[model samples]
Target: MITYDPHKWLDHFFDIRGSLVKEISGRVLICVFWSAGVVYFDKNYHDVNISSLLHTLVGLALSMLLVFRTNASYDRYWEGRKLWGGIVNETRNLVRQATVHLSGERDLVVHLAQLNVDFAAACMYHLRGAKIAGMLESQHPPLTIATQMTFALQEARRRGAITDIILASMDQNVQLLIDYLGGCERIRKTPLPFAYVVHLRRALVVYCFSLPFALVDTYGWATVLDTLVISYVFFGIEEIGVEIEGPFGLDENDLPLEDICTTIRHNLFALVELEHSEPDKMPEGL
Candidate 1:
């Protein structure tokens, strides 16, 4: 996602990158020009004035629909973020547990760490409907890595490297990872209702196009400015919803999956190194 200081008011107005202005600019311009034509025609040739009261009623309904659409999309986005946060925490907890329980078996600890990283990376790719370069062609890469993690824990238990209790604890973390993965998949695969989206967009178009007729009588030439501003607000809100609906994509507003995966890898490797060097030197808030 595009990072910025929200307090910087001037920068936001000047910044065009990753803004919804680009997406709605064309529509706003069309609305402005259409309003101008309507006003000119009404003044010179024929009157096309309509009741502004009708627009008032339609605008209220349109605002409610836009609010609902935006809220639903943001709910999916926030849920996805929360699920990934769970994954991050669980991965750390699992690795920290393994570091303590299997301290003597450095290779096994490293392997477990790498597996966790792989699982996260696989999950990122899987949600995006893509494949990592080295990952084997599998129906579900995250599940494959999850299975490997389970086997590793099982083998540790079988060989008496870790007790049954330790194995169970680590296995629980693995299950949580799968659960988070499922949550993410649900968000990515299940979109908003088709009829709802269709009706919302249709309402927006009808309202914005018909707004010029309502404003031309009172605002005259200024109807163009009013229509442009109103269209921009409505279109921008809808576009923002679409941008964040699927939070796994590469859009500037989408979740930073790539950076998140990289962070998990780095933290795991750092934890491994810390354990190897000084077991007592664990970080404060890992």
Candidate 2:
């Protein structure tokens, strides 16, 4: 996500890197030009009249559409954040359980805890749609980690390192990981409906372009700046919705999955007091 001082409002506004303004600049230019045309036309024949009465009704409808669109997209973004939060919590619980129950078998506990880190990272990679690469060359990294964790648990049970009660408690957290994975997948696979998106975008474009015509008659040449700002708001809101709706990808606005995954790894290693390579140097999927 884009990061800077929130208090530095001007700096934030003017910052070009990773700003949605860059993506919508071309559309803004169109609005400016369209408004200029409205000015020229009004100066000459004055036949073009995109009436204010019509705009009042259309504007209300368009505002509602953009509001709902942004709200729905933000809901998905928040939900995705909560799901990853769940993953972080459950992973910690599972590893802590292993460390506590397998007190005597530090090696086994260490192994399983390390695997939990792997599992968390794998899940992040899975959600972000990154193909497994390097040491994690598998179709399903999370599933692979799940399998290893399961095998280790079974071995611990067989060796009497953990009782049925402890195993069951640990299994609950493992189940939670599975649930988190499925929950994230559901969000990832399902998107805002295509029809809604198409209709809203088409409507927004037409409205922003036509706005200049509707307002210039009343506002005079000043309508250029007015239309430009209004179009920016409309387009920016819709574009923001599109950016966060998925909540997973390489986009600047996407979840910081890499950092989150690395944190899981570093925390797991610290919990076990097991030496690990520096997070920066660690291989991918670690």
User: Using lDDT as the measure, which candidate wins?
Assistant: 1
Candidate 2 lDDT over residue span 98-133, tens digit each = 777887788888898888888877787788777766
Spell out the clash pairs found in candidate 1. Answer: none
Go through the candidates in order and give each one's C-alpha lDDT.
0.91, 0.85
- Candidate 1 least-lDDT 10 residues: 277-286
Per-candidate TM-score against the hidden true structure: 0.96, 0.90
Per-model tally of clashing residue pairs: 0, 0
Candidate 2 Cα outliers beyond 4 Å, as residue runs:
134-137, 274-286
- lDDT per residue, candidate 1, 1-286, as tens digits? 9888889989787788888788889988988888889999999999999999988998999899999999999999999999999999999999998898888888888999999999998998899988778676688889989999999898788778898888888899999999999999999999999999999999999999999899988898999889988999999999999999999999889999989999999999988888877546666775
lDDT of 1 at 282: 61
